[model samples]
Target: MAVRMEELRDHEAVRAVNRAAFGGGHGETVAELVAALRRDDPGALSLVAEEDGEVVGHIMFSRTLLDAPRELVPVQTLSPLGILPQWQGRGLGTALIRAGLDEMGERGVPLVFLEGDPRYYSRSGFEPAAGLGFRKPSLRIPDAAFQVFRLPAYETWMTGTLVYSDTFWRYDCVGLR
Candidate 1:
């Protein structure tokens, strides 16, 4: 399948993809989070991968602040990356991630954070956030799963405790940690 990436404008399609991709007790929560982020975080970047005019995958990056003692470093975090179960292993997820990162970098985003498998995300240059003085804002997340990818505009002084938007916590999604 030829996957085309674009900003997610079809809320219904995106919701369906999220529900199917993360199906379980957590699927609806993630889908709700996407809707909440759309309303609460205007600066958030939400993209979808489409094939044959249908959304097959989705990824989101919401604007956040790293509360360093001296300054609030602006950054974004990757969350709720999803690909249809049937579409898994076809590189759609990877393509969505790469496209999101490139767009963030072009927009001058300094860093990107995510909580996921290091074995999978490491392929995209993500490294342990702790190693770079970045601390998880919540204790619920494991240190090993919390990773960061520094963009071209990243600076050494951008390290600090991450602060996510209320939408993340309200939805009780991955951002809770």
Candidate 2:
């Protein structure tokens, strides 16, 4: 499988992947969130995994603010990582994240945040954010699910509450609730 940046032609395929990965019809929220992020935040980094010309997985990282007491800092937030059901057991989701993180590090992003299952995300170097002195935007998000990955550019003073963009709140996708 080849991982590459998302393009205009990958939108529909990306949604399909999200729906398949996050079923329960709850996937609709994630699908719509990705669209809104793309529309509202053009700089959001999005990537896709393709195999045999088929889009198998998708991931997106959007800007978030760290309301630190020392100084406000800009960071990235990963969300709605989705892989086609058939590709779920494979490493597509993790690959997309590693690729995205690599790109974020290249761009000098200091931190990345996400609310996801620790069992899976831990493999990608994510740790409990609260333990690292960070706070989640919503109490609905479980402490265990609220995670952060510090890149090479990260600084000790960057710990604080993650302020998501309006699109996240508009889509009602900020937390597990």
| Residue lDDT tens for model 1, 61-160 | 9988898878998899899799989989988888888989999999999999998889999998899999999999778888889999999998887888
lDDT of each: 0.85, 0.92
Task: Tell me, by TM-score, which candidate is best.
Answer: 2
TM-score of each: 0.93, 0.97
- Candidate 1 lands at a TM-score of 0.93
- Candidate 1: stretches off by over 4 Å: 1-9, 175-177
lDDT of 2 by residue, 1-177 (tens): 999999999999999998888887678888988999999989999999999999999999999899999998999999879998888888898899999999999999999999999999999999999999999999989989999999999988887889999999998887776
Against the true structure, whose lDDT is highest?
Answer: 2
lDDT at 139 for candidate 1? Answer: 86
Q: What is the Cα-based lDDT of residue 33 in candidate 1?
A: 90
Clashes of 1: 0
